[model samples]
Target: MSVLPLVFTSGWASGINAYAVVLLLGVFGATGLTDEVPASLQRTDVLIVAAVLFLCEAVADKIPYVDTVWDTAHTVIRPVAGGVVGALLAGQSGSLSDITAGVVGGSTALASHFVKAGTRMAVNTSPEPFSNIVLSTAEDLGVAGIVTFAVFHPTAAAIIAAVLLATGLAVLVFLWSRIRRFLRRRAQRREEKRLADGGRIPGRAGPPPW
Candidate 1:
């Protein structure tokens, strides 16, 4: 069977939580759940690194501003991970060209990453941290569930992932205003901090000269 479905699903999941996807796939491969997983992904060193990163993300993703920072840091990492995984999957299955799989995975991950990042920015506009925690937990579960499901039912998982990606994009579009507000507020905060740290120069308390 072709590995496109799994590649697509993994790409979408990778956008939200690349380490989790890697960790889960590695575990599955090591356990002999499936032979489709690449040997490189199942290495002890790779599993350990992925597990550590997943733990870090699981913690950092539940904090509002921290999640946004984490997302910013992974903007490149996620897409690159997706492409590499896709290429490996293709190489193992011999069902598609590595370049083709890599491009599809990387582009899908990039799109979904935008949706995740934009939604998080909008969510950060909320005053409380509970929402972030809830959303983060949901994303982690979703990534885990979908990737595991893909191991057993690739086509079905891909369809579900497509729906999720579409829904997330729609929600992000609806929340564009909130995302913009968050960006503006964040910029203001940075400017305020900079000014505070730099010590503003004294000035006359009068209107500027016309």
Candidate 2:
């Protein structure tokens, strides 16, 4: 059977999000977007992942073009999450089950991550460094929580993950809007400065115009 439903329903991931982190990267261990998940809202492990990803995204924004750069680098890291999840599931089953779970989980995570990353790149310009960072930190916290709760409260893990993921996404959208406004204002100021400097005129008697 699929540990995914187990993981997803068992406080691992939500539906679409389940496909991203738990199914692709965490399950398959691949390193491509075709193997990741969408950036959509999630309720389980996917939510936790969203939080982590949001942080990664924030870091990427801080570095100018590093958002894309982070996306590229994460190809490797994405699958690793899948592997970890698979290993966890396999422990509950037999040896063969573990290996299978690893592959499937990694694959799912990859697909989900790819979709999420692609969407973010397509929509935004530059990056909102601080907001993304906060988003990512939230994700890290969610992941840690899931791991801790998997033993005692599997279902709660899913609920917690969903809550964390949704919160991150909402925060991201909010930050995105604010950042855009800030950038536009900054651009306007720069342009005005340029125009003012260029328009400076000197008296004919003067030798040089500053």
Candidate 3:
């Protein structure tokens, strides 16, 4: 069987939560639920590390600005992880070259990462933290479900993943202007508050307050 479906599905999931994807795949592989998973990922140490990191991510991802920081840090990590997983899946089949699988995985992960980051940025514009928490939880659940389903039904899962990816990108595109405007307004408000608090406005000659 072609591992392309698994590669794409896992890549999409990794963008949302790389550690969760690793943890789930490692667990599933260790438990003999899937034969296509890489042997290295099935190691106990790998599973433990993935689980620990996933826990930290789950907590950090619920916080607004903190989640942004987490996402920024994982920008490279997620794509690399996806590529490694893709290569491993291809290795199992011996039909596709690891490099080809890596390219597919990395590219997919990168695209999904942008979508995740953009959506999170927009959500962070809201003052309430509830939305962030809800979104984070939903992402975790979605990754888990998609990964598990992909193991058994890769082709169907890939189609579903493609649709989701398209929808997310479309929504992001449609709201890009609104999100930018909101960010600009937010910056203006912050600047105004700073100025009101005795901060000098830029582009004006201001006597230094001794």
In order, candidate lDDTs are: 0.94, 0.47, 0.88
In candidate 2, what are the lDDT values of residues 139-202, reduced to their tens digit? 4444444544543454565566556446645655656664466457658988898686665555
Question: Which residue pairs in model 1 clash with each other?
Answer: none
Q: Considering TM-score, where higher is better, how would the candidates rank from best to worst?
A: 1, 3, 2
Clash counts per candidate, in order, are 0, 50, 0
Between candidates 2 and 3, which one is better according to TM-score?
Answer: 3
Pairs of colliding residues, candidate 3? none
Which stretches of model 1 miss by more than 4 angstroms? 199-210
Per-residue CA lDDT of candidate 1, range 102-145, in tens?
Answer: 99888889889999999999999999999999999999999999
What order do candidates take by lDDT, descending?
A: 1, 3, 2
Candidate 2 has a TM-score of 0.43
Q: Which structure is stronger by lDDT: 2 or 3? A: 3
Worst 10 residues of 2 by lDDT: 33-42
